[model samples]
Target: MSLGSHSVMQGDNTLRAWRTGIDTYQEFVVYMRRDCPACRSEGFTTQARVLLSAAGQRSIVATLSVVEAEWLSSGDAGLSESAWAALGAQPGEPITVSHAPPLYSLSHVRAKVYGHKLGDTEFAEVISDVAAGRYSDLHLATFVTACAGDRLDLAETVSLTKAMIAAGDRIDWGRQPVVDKHCVGGLPGNRTTLLVVPIVAACGLTIPKTSSRAITSPAGTADTMEVLAPVDLDIASMRRAVERTGACIVWGGSVRLSPADDVLIRVERPLDLDSEGQLVASVLSKKAAAGSTHVLIDLPVGRTAKVRSEAAATSLGRRLQEVGAAIGLHVSLRLTDGEQPVGRGIGPALEARDVLAVLQGAANAPDDLRQRALCLAGDILEMGGVVPAGSGLTLANQVLADGRAWARFQDICAAQGGMREIPVAPHRQAVDAHASGRIVSVDNRVLARAAKLAGAPTAPAAGIDVHARLGEYVEKGQALFTLHSQAPGELAYAMSYVASRPPIFQISPTGESQ
Candidate 1:
């Protein structure tokens, strides 16, 4: 039987065949045709289809899934499973086979260190297949690999973003310059979004920040905000929340924003590959769909962060700027230091505590947290033209200190659901400074890991709240940090992990410090 240009001629007629094991199936499986001599030659394979068991029970097959000829007209590799069954085969069977059956379309090129760019049509088809769920994990891998290693151009980035937006729910706020800000994440304790949203909203701008739950980290913006208020608002309810308060912090995962990107993210997370093209599309499409006209993107660049080198950071920054403009979004990128996390809290509840402190004007609100929030808010302010040029920082600070930001935050949370105090972990574990000096560097990744081991987003209260910061002097016996946990065992486990590790805190020998 010819599948296409070449005949599916039998390669071998001998008894010799490669044996393969069948999984979870009680009876053996193999392919056969009712009309073939080979089918007649093997009595069991000849029947139209029949069940054979050790008990000698037999059942006749009336019909199969019946995939028609259109599916199998081309290469058998692309053949539908129903077509395979129609030709008579069980998937796990050890069947007699021939040479490669007229399939000449595939190329087996060895992949290089970095991937090459895919054509626009090819890329769109790949995304189409991904969106339609026609591609399996392996096919998705090929799609991702083909476009990996910064392989997309500015137009491609814009196209991909538009495709992603088209694939998901789009929010039309019917307002010009609807503003949003996104952090290309990596710095742990960078819970600035919680502070940024309220401040931007306080300055009479519409800011709807839809955040993600943690994938590999201890906490995400959604996770930290979850510590303060409910974040799982649906599309209609969420829009109402934003309308009532002029701002909303909702969970993006729940509302299906850029849904295909969510699927890609799941695979990307495990592979540890953040493809620049995919990253750009994922960010901007969500912003575009959310109806953002102005976007301030915070790209933290350092050795340990997402965009490590300045060269990579600069390239990414330019790409973001260009792509945003192409998509009709006014864009600005600020590269902050990823050498250290921006806040003293390293988990959801702990970070929520830090944010609340900043909002409520607590005496112990972290200066780094406050400063970054104000700076990012200032950028949004200037970019959205909420404040005059050169005075973004001053305007932001005034709104924050004079109780306007806090008041707005209260209103927004109440509009969503009432504001609640960040919950405290009933169990507390304190770690004293091992060697006191001027605090230097803190490894946020390790610290975040330790917090996860304790209990995080789930435990709400379970996390690390740093009592010390860079350049801060501490006594050897003074408490360096506090670990909060809802359970005693979790507190113990978290404490044990912290104890086994060397000083997460880097301190200088020189006593004189700020």
Candidate 2:
């Protein structure tokens, strides 16, 4: 069989490459655009060809997502994957890709990315693709990874932030200086939004704080908050609550704050890959579009948490602060302890109970959660430039102790539909330690996976509720952790998973006991 160049008809661009192999693994070629130099940088890039009847051209274009190969780690692979998906071409189906305009080429930035701002039309095309569900998760991953690491210069971050904002619905509060806060979350139970919003509103700030349901963890702020109140409110309902009470903590997933973000997150969550640049963009884009004037970023640094060291935290902190300034907002990043989960509770319903207890001033309210919330609220007050530095913490504590935050919380909850208690799953089993000693470490990722095994987030009530934390001493027979599930089978599955992956936690001093 002869392998050689074949000129194929396409609209504006020519696709040419050596026909190298065929049969079994599929016929293959090394393709390149003589006019576009991007292919040269990453060997040969792949582009799937799709044939469309003249009238069918509109259908194909409408169904396709924008593909920019130059910035991807495997731009060639990404382009091949997305284009193949777009063509809806089967294994044996022939495809001819028409030469159409490239949505927004990264070729210009390939020189060194000195400065590049997307024009409106180009911006619209990418958003259209995202909204249309045209791109696969991996393709989205490529977009995120290419932008990973390093802070985009002020001008670039600002432009990208604005473009992301324009990509989705804009909430006009008909007011100035909307208040919001976000944690660069890794701590398991740092459910501060459950407390901060009420305090800020009580202090006369319009905080329509939208949170998320658990993506990977046992719970999210929305999940915990949902235990005491409704979190999945419609956009109109959410806006009305904020308009009426000056604060609302509803889930953004329901209202679509930045829809493109939700799609990207679905891809990133499983891959466990949140590239640095994408993270900054994802966090700030939502805040900017929410019309927030001042935002607080919680950076929890710990040995096992998201940012493992103080140095890492500070580097991220500087980027967030500087970028916020460029985008015309005041951003304050706070460093918090993330050595372990924030509160005594580890799952959704349990965390909700903790939130309510704090609000109602229960004598045994989770102190750790309370302190975290106060620190965040205080910084928020300082950012508003209303509570002077050094005075904000004192004021935040006062709001908590005086019962004003509690009352405001109740009012906001009632406004966000109505308050109720969600029941924890009744089926449960406990895991006791095999030996006695101080709890040396708790592997968060493993623990999170175990919770998933037990049926968390989906099961809602079913999750591991840790009775012991790091440094706590326990008897050999004492309960190390408890697994709750909707069914006995699921509970057993969790137990089996735990047994197979031993030492989710380590006990000190070495000795087998009762």
Candidate 3:
């Protein structure tokens, strides 16, 4: 058996499609036994890019993984969960495997590697192939690395953003001034989008916010939002939520907005490389694709944060504005203090609790989270013309104080499959202060990593909950932060990491517990 255009290569190249049920996130994988007839005749091995064609005209290029298990017969070819979904394969279906086609876009990537700037058409060719899943993980990594460390100039950045937007669906709200907010994330527990959305929506503006999951941090807006409400809504469901409540906070990937950005994120996540141009494109492309006319970006600058310094923030902020302008978005920047995490929680469910506290006006609510949310919401309000420039903060405060934001948030959550109860990790351990002193500084990267090691985002309830703040004095045995994990193993893993590192929190001999 053979496909017409994508015919099988010489030898018996057909195999029965078997579902292995392995989930590799978004990376597609095809499995074959080392001694399989097709593997031997076709010279297939691990990491080999193979073209797979299934029934109903479904096909995908997947990285090959050789298996030696007896359960997988030589005649059977296993497909990972991602590959299975991509091919829409059925059990015992016929599958034809062949060499993946040559990638012509890599030449542009090669040119980029040699310090040559790419044009719009070149970037488009590369991104389109990326969005179509034709590029392997190695190729994706090469392209990403070549673009890292300020390699892409202003023109290239704009072209890349345009290419990204063109690679996916774009929402046409058919209206002016659709608003949204995004944070150039690095600081953990900065889940302000949750508080800002309801506030802005309460002030009579449309905020169809589409957020992303974590790329290089413990949790992102979408991750924290998912802990409160269902975030993986389809395009129609997302529209209904926005129409019914004038706001929606859903994961952008589900709706296929900026599909290329989602693809690029698969590599960027592991590399921890949210590069300059790629980052601007990633943020602005989604905002532009979401049909947001006005956007407020929260750029946090600190020594340990993503931006690191005021100069870097300023440069990034300028590029953001320029790219937003090019993409028809009025981008506004707000550089906030990124000295430490925003809220007490640094994971999905943990951060959700803080969001709920702030929204419900709980007495123990984190003031920093509330105020930061208010400030960003106020900027969005002013930008969208809901209130004047100087009065936006007051109006935002009034909406939150009067419970309008809370009520609106409840409605939004109810529309998106109702609110969920935040989960609690089964295992908890506290990292105590080594000696009585004032907490001078907290390392954002280290804390975020610790939370990730505790199984955050993937395990929504697992993370770190901060109990101490900068300038606060603590006793020798006092808790600086508590590690929460769903399993004792995960808790131990995070504890081991913390144990082998420098103190996450710097302590001074004298001060006043804040």
Candidate 4:
């Protein structure tokens, strides 16, 4: 494996393409027997980087996995789902395996690992390779780690953001003031985007809002919105929905906007590393590529939230504004309370119910959720000049109160495809308090962990519903929260974690836990 060559010595073995039911999160993987002719001829072993070519028209770099099972024979090679889709190979098609070409852009990553700043051209080349799926997960991890913890300066951050935007498809609305909003998420049950999009759109703004699925939380905006209508709209469908209803709520991954961000996100989620520079780049790149002229960023601050303090929030906000301005976007930052989950529900369908309650103006809707959505929507309204500086809240409230936002939401859902009823979990259990006292604190991170353990986002209907609020009085054996799951094993797993940990809800007679 030379580092300076692009030529690959093709192997003599031609194997059948067996589809392995494996999910590698967009990374290509190929499985072959330990004693396969290709492995012996090409000097390939487990974990080797190999180039897979089919029909001389498609080629991809994949990691090698050795299989000892009967599912794959010596003359057969198995492709993971991602690889199979990338190659578009039939089950019995012949494929060639060879040594992968040298990834020259990785040298820049090595320089970054050694504390050297990368130039704009270096970042462009690196991001191009990343977006093209030329890097393995290990390479992605190394690159992400190298850029972690304030390693990238302001200039470098701008370069990276620009590089990321250039690496993906950009949508041009050919219109002014294309508005969008994003929340720096950490707290669970914060599904405000679902409400804010409808409100802003109802005010006659072009708001094609694209959201991501959950990475670490119980639910993401896309995951929750998917419960009511489809969120995986392609660019054309998304445009059509926006044209029909003045707005849309769809998944960002479907549009190829800032594709490098998604590629990096796949690696960042498992590592749990979100550096400041990368965060700014990730947010602004998508906004820029989405044709947004004005953007609102929500920063929720708490001890357990992503932005933990006022100082950190200010710094992040400044960076976001600076990068966004450099990329031709007007960025407005808002710092809000992240003391607890935004609503009573902490999963996909459960959060969708909360959103619907707010939109429909139900008396039982969570006041916190409704008020937060109103505030964000108000700010967005002002940003788009749809309302006066201080009067956006009044207008937003009027729209929601007068049933206009609800009507707009339904129209947008229909335009996106169709609306569906929210689902409910099949199995449920309530966790009760052991001692009676006024509740003082709730750990957002722990509660979110329990919800994920209960199979949220993935299970669609699985999550937790809160019954106790901060400073609320409770009796011994009173219900504090209910866990929803699709399977008994998942419910048991969440319950076991809750049983072993400190009470997620802290209560004291004096209310001093805060």
Candidate 5:
């Protein structure tokens, strides 16, 4: 079949495809010279939607950018890394460039902006367009903003979740009671997934765990898992790893599951807009798409955490359960203390170190992290019917205590790839308490920001090592936390930010250093 028969071929306007070597993540971009013949004739402006078709009948609608540089000849149209891969075009191959057809789904987005409720069909159209890369960044941002806060009702939230699930690949494990776990993130150093997966898998449950990289925090499960082993596993590798070890901890994005949720997240991250409706949809869509029949949700509630008050936690938890029920998932919620970071570390390599310590049952391991992981793992085990309701904790603890969880972790890592050596940052600086007192509070947001400034998930080895916890007494000049960074400048940046702000660790005057 000819490409012209299915797609709109606007005249014979075409240009030679040239690699521009630009990386824009998932957004496809096409570059054309300012004086290019096709640009002048088609009246295509920068950021204009244009369809690029290659010889093999492949096509993609990309946002156009007019290049002022003379690097491209008049006849050549440059392609960004995303566009180049999408079209599968060779060097100097002719690519047909034309104005993209108008998007009809955008009307639904506009309706949402004016406080209108969107139905299943409406959301489906909008998400389908979004997944197909038809909507540009502006359109995506608009869609996200319109649905922000309480703008989306329960029905709309359910519809949106269904739409997101439909837009991406879904896994079917060909069995009953496939289990998984997720955290409603805001707390830092809470890497329970790494511990939970192995415990559950060691107990003989099928857990194909897919995690996301850090969206708003210093390290996500995937980032920390990457520090210990290869986490960017595709679907086939993930399946193989699970088959071998009864579990797999891999990045969800690589498997192309809930793709539209990823796209929405890119916009939501920069905006720092995690609406309840969208948050529910984002977490549950990924869970549902992973073919999970039973799921455990960890909600860490604190004044400085994502879910602050008890009321907020209750509402969000109910919404999660309601949404999961509507989508055929049996959801279990575990609310925990978010008063402080989970463990002693706050970055990829640092958190991985903590995870290793807990799994290996080291005496000095962070007791808080270990307990939280066991609790969440226990919940998953019970939810999967592996253990009777109250007995899950004992079973989970026994697995960890006997070194079974640690051994299974090694097996899973080996299955994914070989276990990797945890990285160390060459530069480090400590932030100290100026006065002696008992630690009263620790701000999660400040610590997270300081970790990011220290070059976190990006640098892998960079992060903070927390020294003080709530109710602990410290002497003047005692270290509160130490910053780790690969570069001196990053170390300095994190230190400066910590200094400029109120003490991250609040200490009430207790007269003497204990």
Candidate 6:
């Protein structure tokens, strides 16, 4: 067959598209036989960038993944779920594969790599191309790495934030002082957004909060909230929820607010890199797009947290304030203690239980979680002018104590969707204390890693439950923390990690732990 403008020219190279049902997050991917006629004719190798078009109507650029299996015929092409959705193809639609167009924005990326700052227009073009699925994972990694380690100056960071906001839909609440909160995350079990939203909303403030899923940690706010209520509300549904209950907690990715942040997050998480400029851009863009006028950012600083030193936290906080102001967002930064995890539970369902316990005023609620949430909510209340500076905590406490927060929480949950009972992991095991002594320092990073190994966030019910706190004395056989997993293999893997590492909880013979 002769080659068309967008078709590969090889013997019978018109391939049938098959859905692989593989989830690649954001990047589109296509799988084909390594020795297929189209592959040889088009000079396509594994990981080559290719343009896929179907029915002359839909097209997307996807990275090629060559297979050496019989599952795919020589004339068949497999598309990942992202690619399938992008193309809107049927089960057996004919697909044409061709070379992708040159990425003109990559020149800007290269410039940034060479220590040159990108102009506003350049950043806009790059963000637009990235949002349009024109950039592959490789390109994305280069952009992320180039901008890492404070390489993006303040002006460039502001420009990037604006570009990110412009690349996606923005929510307009049509009201003044739309309030929200975000945590510069690192500490595990810091699910304060779940608590702060209810408290602030109970005070009759508009808090249409959008949260992200876990990237490197055990659970993100959305993951914990998902254990209680559906968090995948679309824009209309989100608006309805806020109209009904004055608040909503939904996953931000579903509403396409600052969508490039989501795409970049997929690349940034595996590298475990949260560059200062990118973090500022990522946070403020979402807030600005969500129509937030007043936002409180919780910055946790500790030796093991995201911002390890006070100096670093101060610098990040200043940048956040300056960027938010530039973008017309009233940002308030609060540096909180990040010496350990906030709540007793460090996973989705486990953390959800902690949130519920605090909201419902259960006697056994974790005090640290409750106190931290109250403090943050107080700051938000003060920022929004709900109460005076010193009385925000009193008012927030009253709302929680009088059952108003709980009622409002239930209303919000019902509005998002009907609230559901949080699940529990089927398999559980406790890591015992090695010796009887006072608990010293806890490595937040190590604990988070163990929870991830236990299948947290992904498994929803999987994570670690800390039973011992710093300075608390424990018996030799006492439980330091319990591991919860849906699968026994995951539980064993987490346990193996704990076994091979230095004690996650340091024990002291005398004196208080730092």
Q: In order, what lDDT does every prediction score?
A: 0.70, 0.67, 0.90, 0.91, 0.91, 0.91
Once fitted onto the true fold, the runs of candidate 6 whose alpha carbons sit more than 4 angstroms away are 1-13, 22-25, 34-37, 512-514
Q: What would the TM-score be for candidate 2 when compared with the true structure?
A: 0.75
lDDT of 1: 0.70
- Tell me the spans in candidate 1 whose CA falls farther than 4 Å from its real position: 1-116, 153-155, 510-514
**How well is each residue in 376-462 modelled by candidate 4, as lDDT tens digits?**
999999999998799999999999999999999999999989999999998999999878899988889999999999999899999
Of candidate 6, the 10-residue stretch with the lowest lDDT total is: 1-10
Residues 1-514, model 3: lDDT tens digits: 2112223333478888878888887899988879877888789889999999987778999999898766677777888899999999888788898999988999999999999999999999999999999998899999999999889899999999999999999999888889998988888999898899999988789999998888667888889888888999999999999899999999888998889888888888788765889999999999998999999999999878888999999999999999889888899999999999998999999999999999999999999999999999989999999878899999999999999999999999999999988999999999999888888888999999999999998999999999998888899999999999999999999999999999999887866323
Deviation in angstroms for 202 in model 6? 1.1
Collision count of model 2: 6
TM-scores of all candidate predictions against the true structure:
0.75, 0.75, 0.94, 0.96, 0.95, 0.95
Model 4 bad stretches (over 4 Å):
1-13, 68-70
lDDT tens readout by residue for model 1, 120-151: 45445555545543333444456566556666
Q: What would the per-residue lDDT of candidate 6 be over residues 1-514, giving only the tens digit for each residue?
A: 2111234334445687888878988679999888777788898999899988889578899999998876776677888998998899887678788989898899999999999989899999999998888888999999999999879889999999999999999999999889999999889999889899999999988999999988788898889999999999999999999999999999998899998989888898888776999999999999999999999999999889888999999999999999998999999988999988888999999999999999999999999999999999999999999898899999999999999999999999999889998888999999999888898789999999999999998999999999998879898889999999999999999999999999999887674663
TM-score of 6: 0.95
Question: Candidate 5 on 1-514: residue-level lDDT in tens?
Answer: 1111122223447787878889987789998877777788899899899999988789999999887865666677788898898889998788888999999999999999999899999999999999888989889999999999899999999999999999999999999889998889889999999999999999899999999999678998999999989988889999999889999999988998989998899888888876999999999999999999998899899989999978898999999999999999999998999989989999999999999999999999999999999999989889989889999999999999999999999999999999999999999999999778888888999999999999998999999999988898899999999999999999999989988999898888963323
lDDT of 3: 0.90
Deviating ranges (above 4 Å) for candidate 2: 1-128, 149-156, 510-514
lDDT of predicted model 6: 0.91
Candidate 5 — which pairs collide?
none
> Which model is ahead, 1 or 4, in terms of lDDT?
4
In model 1, state the lDDT of residue 123.
46
Tell me the RMSD of model 4 versus the true structure: 4.2
Instruction: Using lDDT as the measure, name the better of candidate 2 and candidate 3.
Output: 3
